[model samples]
Target: MIVGIDISKKWFDAAWQVDGQGRHQRFEYTDEDIGQLLAQTPEAAHYVMEATGTYHARLALRLHESGRRVSVVNPLVIKRFSQMQLSRVKSDRADAELIRRYGEQQPLSPWAPATDEVLELQQAHGWLNDLIGERTRLLNRREAHAHHAKPNAFVISQMAAQLQQLDGQIKTCERHLEVMVKKSFTELFERLLTIPSIGAKTAIELIIVTDGFRRFEDVKALCAYIGVSPTTFRSGSSVNGKGGIAKLGQGRMRQLLYLCSWTAKTCNPACRALYARLKALGKPPKVINVAIAHKLLRQAFAVATTNAPFSTEYA
Candidate 1:
């Protein structure tokens, strides 16, 4: 048996295939409703749903705890899958049916929740990201006001106070993150720092994004998830296009890797050699930077997997 669920903030639409017959139902987003649904599902049944942010977390967790197989797919994958259907109709019920069909027809890896420590780190990282974004917005507004012909004194004062408060909050979040990393991911944190150009912030981000490196199967999988993997376009003989990194994965992780690549190219020997060779071949700077970032990620993977610090001579 296979079950598919379409999740929303208030409720979820569920569909299932049983003995070659299809069934559908709607449930409120609550523990009681989830338990009721689970009670009727077969013990060996597989549950599938899209990764709809925090909305899907509770359901997935509950299903997992009940010993049911669950697959939380990416939303992009689901959207593309929907396009394959001939009907153009769109609704929650239709989406649930498609998801159920997707699970029945495709092979998917089972989903696993991260450890409590990693989850905490992820939450802390989210807080830090939000605070940083707020700070950037405030700074941009302050800059715009400063360039005015006659800046308002009151506005400037208000902005200053808000900026100061944000700065303090940001610092506190950073401290909390540091303490969490040290306590929960001490070895990985220290190991990542040993890599050239990787600092505390990058290490924390990597740990959070990779879920302590438990989310991916290997280095290439990690690169693909980070959107640093090169993608090639080819359609028959005439439609061939240039290869470039696919920007379909985590944007923030890619951005951070790109920034780290700038420093890695100069300090990391392997990266430096790769950069020199690419530059000699007249590759564009952006392409070269992405390549460097890819190399750095591979190195991080190697170090993390092997439980060893990065060493240029042995690398």
Candidate 2:
């Protein structure tokens, strides 16, 4: 039996069907109901669920404990598929049924959770990003206040203290993240870091988001996966504008690359020359930034694929 679980914060809906059977069963969302359903039919082949925030993890854990094969599908992919035939209606029960039928008919890829250590790395990266963003905000506020009127002594002092705390936390997080990356993904880490603008955080992010670079065939595919590939917008007899990136893949990876692009094109001579050439040819600064990010992304992919440090010569 293959079953699809549509999970929510409070409840879960189940759609189940057997391989050679004509009838299918749909169960309304409920807790403790899985145990009963499994008891009635214990020969489960695989149980699939759509990835919803923390909502689906607990149920997945329970199902796994009962020796059921469980997989989570990316919700974005599911949503796209769901819109094809139905194109309009959406409901918990209907979604569950859709997932079940799709699982049976579409030969969709199954989702596997990352290993514990990788999950830890991702969590650490998320925390570090949060701290960095908060610190930036605090610093911006401090700058604006100090430049404005004569700032109140107490308020300025408090802001300074908070900024210092955030700074300390950010450093600590980076240190721990570096240690973890070196410990877990050593050779790949060392090789990739040689590339300009690449760091422990960015490297770890690519690893986690790519699931150790397993999915894509090569570096260029990885570039597309990273979402730096330029997309086109066209009309009847006109190419209107080439806007920002697709923003389709790993968001953290995209954001990290954007930050790297700004520095990479400044500090790395090869990339800086590319930026200057683009600008002199009348390409916008933002366009140059995107192009630089694209190069860095492809270079990172090359480093991973060839097990070599990124080389400027490309020879």
Candidate 3:
């Protein structure tokens, strides 16, 4: 038995199949509702739900605590499954049914909650990103005000104060994140830092995202998960296009890797050689950077699995 749940901010819809027929129910986001739903389903039934940001966390955690089997899948996977089934209905009820059928048909691994340290690092990283975003907005506002013909001194001073404050907050958050990583993943953090162009922040971000590298077993899967793996688009000679990243995974991580690639191409021996060879072949700058980012991920994975620091001599 499998129950598919479509969760929202306030409620969720659950669907399952019984006697070759469909059964569906809606419930509020509460302990009582969750208990009732569990009672209604078979003890052996598997519950599957999409990872809907933080909205699904409460229910998923509750389910796991109650000893029910829970599988939290990526939303992209469910979207692809829906497309394959030619699903046209776009309601919560339909989504729940689709999720149920997906669980029943596809092989899925159970989701594991992140450890306390990793979770705390993730929260801190998210806060840092938010602060960075705010800083950017403040910068743009300052620039706009500067060109305001009159350029009010009062507004400019306020913006400057705000920017300084945000910078301090961002630095504090980053420092806290590094401390958390060092406390829980000291060896991994140090190892990752040995890779050229991979600084403390990048290493911390990778650990937080990969849950200390327990989420993936190999470099290939990690590359794909980080959205740095190459994707081809060619059906026949008549229909062909340039290959690029799939861009179906973590966008923020992908962006961060891309930024790191700029430095990696110059300092990292392996990446430098690859960049030179690709540049010789006339590959575009963006294409070359993506490749370097991919290479960085490969190095990160290798060091993580081998429990060793990266060495330029190995290049």
Q: Which candidate is the best by TM-score?
A: 1
Worst 10 contiguous positions by lDDT, candidate 1? 80-89
Q: Give lDDT tens digits, candidate 3, residues 1-315.
A: 999999999999999988988899999999999999999998888999999978988898888888889999999899999999999999999999999989989998997677677677777877888898899899988888888779988998899899999999988888888888899999999999999999877888898889889899787888888888898888977869889898877787888888999999999999999999999999999999999999998889889888889988764
Q: lDDT tens string, model 2, 51-70?
A: 89778876777677777778
Q: Which of candidates 2 and 3 is the stronger one according to TM-score? A: 3
> Which candidate comes out best when scored by lDDT?
1
Error of 1 at 292 (Å): 0.9
Q: What would the TM-scores of all predictions be?
A: 0.94, 0.78, 0.93
lDDT of each: 0.90, 0.76, 0.90
Cα displacement (angstroms), candidate 3, residue 19, comes to 2.1
TM-score, predicted candidate 3 vs. hidden true structure: 0.93
Deviation in Å, model 1, residue 157 alpha carbon: 2.0
Q: Model 2: runs farther than 4 Å from truth?
A: 18-37, 40-44, 61-69, 86-90, 136-158, 238-243, 266-281, 312-315
> What is the Cα-based lDDT of residue 89 in candidate 3?
93
Q: lDDT (0-100) at residue 79 of candidate 3?
A: 98
Candidate order by lDDT, highest to lowest?
1, 3, 2
User: What TM-score would candidate 1 get against the native?
Assistant: 0.94
